[model samples]
Target: MTDTSIEPSADAPAQLSTLDRFLPVWIGAAMLIGIVLGKAIPDLDETLDAIKIDTVSLPIAIGLLAMMYPVLAKVKYTRIGESLDRRSLVMSLVLNWLIGPALMFALAWILLPDLPEYRTGLIIVGLARCIAMVLIWNDLACGSRELAAVLVAINSLFQIVAYSILGYFYLELLPEWLGLDSDGIDVTMWEIAKSVLIFLGIPLLAGFLTRTIGERAKGVEWYEERFLPRIGPVALYGLLFTIVILFALQGEQITEQPWDVARIAVPLLIYFALMWFGSYFAGLKMGFPYERNTSIAFTAAGNNFELAIAVSIGVFGVTSGQALAGVVGPLIEVPVLVALVYVSLWAKRRYYDTDGVRPRS
Candidate 1:
């Protein structure tokens, strides 16, 4: 589903279908629509391409910014210091950056050994950890919004450094070790840094300012109860719009060989499911309660695909396999995470303690 918070939108309808509950149908429809348009309007990318400055597409950049601003606006800054549940934070970091990346490295090599572009694209996706939308998934599962918010705050900054270093290491050096071709896939650390700065850094600052000023002026209650709800759906709607343009640009590439899209999606599906289960069980074994554990699970399982796609397009070309893979990310992620959302809900009731209390180790 869309990555908006579980907080009900100010203007939401009371009833939501299974399709409405998750974003797969909507996101998938967007993908198909983009693809169809791409096929129908073979020159669509060119038309969009005309409205660009330097390498960055103005429309795409704005679309990407719109997707993240709402999520950033809701960061509970006070919790940045107070929400340090040491056990939960450490586990999330390990699963997200360390184990998760290693798992992706293995999967990418095994699954996409030959296709370096697609393989590198998947690895880039792994390097960029979830910041914004996992908050949405975490909230939906009745997890700690504060913990989710704090982790996002931490990861948003961490990604600036970690993504570039890891991107270089995995996308560059890892291939050297495996003896795979490392030719045109040389997207340097700086390239990623630039994209992260524009895509993530701006939103983080804006979100922080929005929260700090809004709370100070309008009062915390109004900011949370009224302002947050109004902007809540922006990220979701932005995501759909970005997808249309992405698939439209990627149309020829996608239509020429549709199976490549499926191939790239394979590792992403495995990563999301495995990481979620791994984090969930790890939390239980470590004795964190259900709410805290779900926060850890979703944070580890979800990805910052907005950053991934932007970096891929900036570093790799818009029509490059890497960018295409980045676009395909949400197509797979929304559904997989939605299923896991249900799975987490089931586990919340059947497997986890409803009271969300566990003894310290």
Candidate 2:
């Protein structure tokens, strides 16, 4: 059996490279730089808008593809079917699909009742569940790589099916059912599905093929250590590039409407806390091992911001408040989830023994 557990270390942050360590800083810098460029260049948005692939800006689409590829490639496709019987997997599905989105819908409506576009954008973020960086967060907390990999693959597959359905439910049907006013998404379910197919399906297939072929030709060690390391940094570069272009497109709106950004953040902050802590303690009560618990918690808490950004831009124009709300997701998520790594560690010590087994109360 593949050893799925990450070896625990004293410094979880030390497990990360400097680039990952200062990710939020880099993203902030990218935003500032993009804003500066937008302010400097009078026709930046027009230039970006000139080219499009299925309603997404060509430049942003390129960046989104770049950002998603390496991360998906890191998933262990071979390990997917290994341990499907575990209760943790079922629990994770419930948290990710049912609870997570419903909570976001409630919070977005409750907190931003006046701002429909931003509200719709946050709902999209909630639906685009974690398939990317939760692996890093899980590993950082010394969680189960085997479970994380399997869970990610399952979530990735589930995304292609559930995202559009959930999008319609929350964005259109739910509001009308409850007598709440909604602008309603202009795009058809097919339009949303097409976006998902392009942005997520393409990268997911590429990543799976890359790993499968690379491992077959070169063996797992070289494929993982050498090739993956070389291409891994490309994900960060792509994310920053996308952010820069996104901010450049909406620099004036973001700068002029700073309070609007702040309002979007409040619901996100509450959502992250509620999901992470709620999942963690729920795992504890269910008597999950520490590693699996950590894995479930992070997986449940994180959002696929890359997919969210892509879909928002695809369905709503790049300049819309919906896209801006999607962009703000990672900006808030990165820092908040990073802090939760320490919180996970602290919970382990507080509730579980050194062997990662919880004590009976």
Candidate 3:
């Protein structure tokens, strides 16, 4: 029988390395390389664009699933119950589900009100919360690893249901409220459900099974120290490849409407900063310890762009403005969050005692 005992903890030093450290630089390079390749080779880009059935690119689907696998496999679903002690979990949940999506909705409307495609793209991005990367940020900020794991696990479970249901309503209702064209709002539950099932559901199941089987077969030490490390970077490698394909496919849009990328970025930038600080201050006001506060801040601020991009392409099209917005999300988020990792650490130092006490004032 398998031990089924592995769960991510804040206590373990983040598994980040030099390559992981420079992830943003590598992602940026991927974008540039994609753009150049798409522009330079017309036949290659056309061939990739044509390699799709049911509007989902085969290459992209493979890359996204591959990228997602390693990340999902590490989730310690077993530890979720114990990690729920902190009231701050409530704060993080509210931020992720209620506040975060609503804020993104308002920002997208306010910033890109007339541009429905772009607005819808941002809306898609807003609804999909971060599940995996927040763990990395949590570790970097010296936040509660246990709580981060719990929140991520909760989100991981919630998203398979919430993403489709919430997406259906938000995309449908919000446009009518704001008086934008309702065409993009016609996404069906089936579409959102299909995207979630393919993009998130498959990997989650695979992750659970892989961990269960591997631990049972090889014991914990070999599974953790050897097996885990080998598969750890698969998702990132897949990300680079997917980015290349996405940008290559949309090279024309990128080159012709260069400002579109910047336009999509505005709401994302505002969203990231606002979520981080808003949650940070809210946690402090509620008297959460620094550890819980940082966890809340990063969890609120980060997004699962992989799911967002996959869903956008599934629901919208690969070359859609929505997909473009989804692509731009991680592009802007990584660097911004990288800088904010420091901000979190500095804030930890400035406002909290070394013992995780919140400063008065």
Candidate 4:
């Protein structure tokens, strides 16, 4: 449960790994392929179209399941008890649920009010917090994995409930506070809940169950060492493919309304910068080690786009402007975070004297 070896490497490049390096490229390729397929083979579109149930989108579900399997496999549930830090847990909860969403709402309102379409997108981004990609960011930043795991669970729980309730209040009730009219927009709590449950709950449960069973049968060490690392890349690829498909489905919208992308991008960029520095300074003030501080910073900075996308689509319909905002998040998020990883490493060397907690080999 404790990290005692592998100090931070001072000489490593501020760049993505072999797998990470190519992931965005692959994602782009998948999106192009999906668009071509959607356009060329209308039957394929029909087949993809037919694979839906009620509010749940099947292709997204499958992609999420694939994405989560690797993440779940890395989770050491046994360490949950041993690794539990009450202070860290409380800090993460307060930040994600109370401060994170509140700040996001404030920023979105301040930055995105002029454009209603982008404003809805900002709301979706605010509602959906970091769950999955935070882990990758934490790892890159040399943050505490144990704390990341705990935060992921906490945020996921909050997202299911808060995303619905908060989203409703934000879109419906809070408009008056911000001096905006709410007569035309229809926001439903039921729709939000249903989408979170379908997209998040099912895949989360499946991934957890699969991991639990695998661990019980083969043991944790074996599951982590033998199975997870191998399948991790596959899951990542699946997620990218799913993203491409979603984008392709909305390609016409993106192509036609190109200005909308830049509109959402502005607030999202501001939010990311604010959260990154906010958490970083907060961690430094708290006197946490560099690694733990980096972990906290990135965990707070990242957004759970999968959950955001699903909730947006469910709440605003797949073709709505809000869903388009959700889609744009990942496109901006990936490259920025990869750059931040290197920045973190640079900061660690420049600021802290590394006598403890060496970087991983």
Report the error of model 2 at residue 95, Å. Answer: 1.6
Off by over 4 Å in 2: 1-6, 139-142, 314-316, 355-361
lDDT of 1 by residue, 82-168 (tens): 666777778878888889889988898899878888887887788888865676566556577677877776787677667767877
Enumerate clash totals for all models, in the order shown: 1, 0, 2, 5
- Lowest summed lDDT across 10 adjacent residues in model 3 is found at 1-10
Q: Please, what are the lDDT tens digits per residue for candidate 3 over residues 1-361?
A: 0111232232222444656657678878998888888788876655985787675567877877877677556655676565566577677788999999999988988888778888888888888898655665665556665677667767766776688777866787666676656445445556555655666678778988998998899987897778767886776788778778867876667787878888888889999999999988888888787777887799899988767776777667767788788877877886788678767766766776656675557
Instruction: Please list the Cα RMSD from the true structure of every candidate, rounded to 1 decimal place.
Output: 4.0, 3.6, 4.7, 4.5
Q: Write down the lDDT of every candidate, Cα atoms only.
A: 0.74, 0.79, 0.73, 0.67
Query: What value does the lDDT take at residue 353 in candidate 2?
Result: 74
Q: Quote each prediction's TM-score.
A: 0.84, 0.84, 0.79, 0.81
lDDT of 4: 0.67
Q: Can you tell me which runs of candidate 4 are displaced by over 4 Å?
A: 1-8, 11-17, 27-50, 183-224, 355-361
Q: C-alpha displacement of 174 in model 1, angstroms?
A: 3.0
Per-residue lDDT of 84-192 in model 4, one digit per residue for the tens? 5666667667667777777777776787777776677777777778877777566655666566777776777676567767776777788877788542234455655
Error of 2 at 24 (Å): 3.0
lDDT of 2: 0.79
